[model samples]
Target chain A: MSAAGGLPRTGSALAIWPALRRSGLGPGLLMLAVVTGLNIALQPDFFSGASLSGNIATFAPTILICVAQAVIVLSRELDLSLGAGVSLINCVMASLPQDKVGGPLGVMAIAILVAILLGAVNGLLVAYAGLPSLVATFATGAIWFGLALTIMPQPGGVISDAIGDRYAGTLMGIPVPLLIIAVAMTGWAILARHRSGRRIMAVGSNPQAARDAGIPLRRTKLLAYLVAWILVALGAIAISAQTLSGDPRLGTSYTLASVAAVVIGGISLGGGRGTPWGALVGALVLGLVTNVIYFAGIASSWQEFVKGLVIVAALGFMVLEGQRRA
Target chain B: MAFTRRGFTSAGLGLASVAALGGIKPSQAAAPVTIGLSNGYFGTEWRDQMIDASKTQFAMYENQGLAHKLIVQQAGPDTAAQIQDVRNMIRSRVNVLMIDANSATALTGVIHEAKRAGIPVIAFDQAVTDPYAINVGIDEYDWGKHYAEWIVAQLKGQGRVAVMDGVPGHPAAVARRTAFMDVFAKNPGIKIVWSGYGMWDQAKAQAVMATVLAATPHIDAVCTEDGMGLGIMRAFQAAGRPVPIMTGEAQKSFLLAWKKERDAGHDVHLFARSNPPEIGRTAVGVAVRIAAGRKLKPLPDNTYHYPIKVEVTNDNLDQLLASVADKPDGYFLGEYLSESELDKLFV
Candidate 1:
């Protein structure tokens, strides 16, 4: 298969080469290992079950959004509103009165619906209105954020102790958050095998060529957005559970974090070129770096400075790898 | 050549210095205590002052054999990161956990976790909702009420007031704003025209005030908290409007501005209160006392309201200025209760 085949073929000789060349998985995984090793060496409790579960639970939201962000990036688009989208869902879910609004389950259901609707809005703006995904999502993200602020105003709302406990709980010896992450990755792996999945890659790789090949360009992009929004909603729910409260400004950090994770996972920003699994690993890498930096006893003032340096170095490595491949 | 043999002499000198520090009272020495300060917000002058005051207090404690070490970790305005910082402190087994919580309710879970481990958590400045944590610092409601009363007095019970609050919904901001609202409501004639949050940010407050002034033509007094008072004053000056009778905080810049305006015959009726960053020091004092198995004064609530020392007006402006005269421009003229004063809280 040609390198231009967009999506990698599963279980073929061509599969390994294309996956190796386009996905950037090998380097991303390597970086994950190095960071994990550093963290383990520095943090004595890195392997402790409680610590592991807690860290992963904290990281679960970022991991989920990275998967969604990877999909949007795979389709040659970006969703700057993913964070605000999560914040909106969180605020709404929190604001709903369990007694008057049919309880937490009903709130969850409505949250998912709102997520899909938000995705559709982003899709319509990008696919029909012909606005740049960057600008469109940015504007819409601000709107979502504003709406969240209006709904919650301050960071106060009860998300019930039961849901909060479950979110931070373990399931059959595995952390529930880890299980959720596994399910998201497994779902993506299955989806990426479908025909629509192939079209997503093709649309991202060469939109003009995909149209020439009779691909439904608009529908594919919209589908990608809808899927991404659903994933973002999942992340929102997870954070809401973890916090057990609604914060209007919650998840504001996820917008850039998602993009950073995608880039670090070896996904190219210019087009479709990487796997969601790589993005998952990328999220892990960032989480581990945070741990390692803490354990390293670096001065607090320089922690942010060091984190930025690490991310920039990861980006530089990706660039160099791309240059080598070409 | 003599250095190798003199190594023991140097070690002896080290021991002598230790003995000198230990001379305060050997009976007071017990197992060295480790205190961790987990600060969520950074870069603000108030936060900087708070940390500095705490560090200075720690040094004093170290000399007095009260504490062995102080570990401070400050991250940006992320609650998750702040939680992680607290957890890290827990893992380090700090004897007392002092946190300036970013959220009123978000840190409850972790605070409970710390409690389970027998680490007494003290939430200061910005408090947490966790019942297990001993919340400290000035009573935010009273902090606001003092200024609100002044505003009411200045306006003679009725005036159009614009309120600039801290981070909206922040425990301190909420309490302060609520207190102000209650006072205004009771006065009946007092009308609040506009209110916005500065997020306790100076530049943001200045900008917000500028726009608010543009939209609202008639304004009698501006009610604001620390960190934003100077910005609000700057906004008034920028708009070429006579600075209104406003409530202020004990920040040096604001005091200097008050003095400048007063000296210029501008009739600046500024009633300033001190939100002493020294609460950080008092928190350490409280935490160390609690960790030593000492009992605290009984309180109706979990909160221990620290005392305020400076409530400045034109009458006391000279004294306040003299107090901070030798200090830098950014010095916060706030007082933390001395050890003797804090002793009153002990059984």
Candidate 2:
């Protein structure tokens, strides 16, 4: 790396901005813009205040889960258990007796605490026990799902109509979920600016160099997972507010969804470079795709097929965009 | 075919909520009030029809000085979210809440909360068992018993029978299954070889039927209390097995398939009954009335059992449902919502 006008320059003019072209987040943002714009065009009324607000509201949960996946990936790790983490939270929160269910703060604390504990188990298995993160989290995810099944076999509990209404409601003229996401992203950007965070990124980009540089590899790996778990827990909270109920199967589809979102955003499956905005944009793309397909009046059966096609196109775009610069 | 069983009403209606809780006294001088409604499941057409009838009935009430707003939902079939929606409605202080519960027990607490919030609740399709939640749906036990009786009749009083049940432990499934077995106690000629749990998935039921056919050599008849289980016929068709006699209620498609099977010399009968959506909407109406301060009785029979009108074959299914679907105004708290009934001023 060499500095040109205080900015790193390399390769060709394209390589001069290689970070922009190589950056996974850029294509992901493009996908988001396409999906959102297409949605607006497809259903003129889809841009109505309530509908647009709902778009933002629904995106929060999926974005959170994707970001969680992104963080884990950035640490040369994966946590397939995130969707299961969300499912577990749903069962736990809904199982709370309606009368006995405490306030939002209490329920949120317990949900996050349980999720972190589950995450720690994943960390211990992968970082200390030397099991691969993929297999470890996959197994733990199954166990978590089983636990959710045992906790609330059927949906119940009255999520404080108040909390859901408050958080899901628009503030002034914007969907509150969007506001929350903005706040979360800024905080994440600040964290990414720190030295430890840079080390995590370096560790993701090149594990050998990170090790040679004497990074506390296992601890860094463990913290990445913890952060991921926290995001998964937050995703469940957003979903809970949206649905106002805890459905065991509610989080079932989100596992593949989060992975799809991150990958679509140009995040590498092999683990390395990615960004928070990439995950957010990826989720918005998928969500908009769903809305568009349904608005197109396609049958329910077609939904799966259409989404599958979108994922393929997204991957191709990401790879092409990456190679054109390379 | 005449449909001349003039829709009439008896005085024994829900007197528990409105009259007792409502502070206002009815002097019979007000316009009908409009009530907003929302529900789930679009795959169920009978439910849609039932809702249509409920709206007609509600309109008739408005003609007689009462009204309603219908808004059903399809939220990915997520029940907890639906419950949360209802909770929000209660907080918004809807006069009364009527629900065709997805979970028999799970909704009990929400029903109770609505009641505590000064909104009466009516559990129409599925009972909640909450003391405050009044039950108004079919007598699922009787529903099961009737299905068994029909199956026995199809077998000419005896055969090897099996149950393709709904979701395990579902209130309807339990009631229908238990009533069927209880009814079978008297018909010694019928032997139940296996009870397959299909979870109300059509494809799953078809598969279950295939598995049952493979294992049970003497299975002569198959019965399911839910309309979705008729997939057994499709299962039998696919496997080319001797189609066992099949039965269920209120699905036109099933009845059409049943008629096809019967016409082609297969043994399948339709225990033609109605979906619970009507009961669901009516439960809401009753709750609203309670909140409005009208007097009501402790719902007739403690649990209102919609009549068991069996449409023996295709012709009968059409005939039965036509009467159900084309009523001037569907069955209301007391009678058919007639034009005169429909003529009452707006609420």
Model 2 TM-score (B-chain only): 0.74
- What TM-score would candidate 2 get against the native? 0.64
**At residue A263, what lDDT does model 2 achieve?**
83
Question: Highest lDDT among the candidates is held by which one?
Answer: 1
Candidate 2 error regions (>4 Å)? A1-19, A34-55, A98-102, A124-139, A165-183, A216-218, A288-310, B1-145, B148-161, B168-194, B210-221, B227-246, B249-310, B313-347
lDDT of 1 by residue, A1-326 (tens): 44435554565665566556556776777788898999888878878877788788778888999999999999999999988898899889888885676676777788889999999999999987889999999999999999999998888787776667777787897788888888887877788899898899999989999999999999999999998888888888888876777877777888888888887788888767888887788888877777777678766887767667757876887887766656
Best by TM-score: 1
Clashing pairs in 1: none
RMSD of each: 8.0, 9.4
True contacts kept of 1: 0.30
Q: Please write out the lDDT profile of model 2 over residues A1-326, one tens digit for every residue.
A: 32123335554764535464456665667677887777778777675665666566657888888988888888888888887789789778766754454677777778889888988899889888989988988999999988887787555555666657667577877677887777667767877898777777877889899999998788888887887788888888887775566656667667888889888777877677778677777888877776665455443345457778878987897777555545
lDDT of each: 0.81, 0.65
CA deviation > 4 Å runs, candidate 1 = A1-21, A99-104, B1-31, B158-160, B189-194, B197-199, B211-218
Worst 10 residues of 2 chain A by lDDT: A1-10
State the lDDT of candidate 2 residue by residue for B192-244, as single tens digits. 89986887767788788788778877777777866555678777778777666
**What lDDT, from 0 to 1, does candidate 2 have?**
0.65
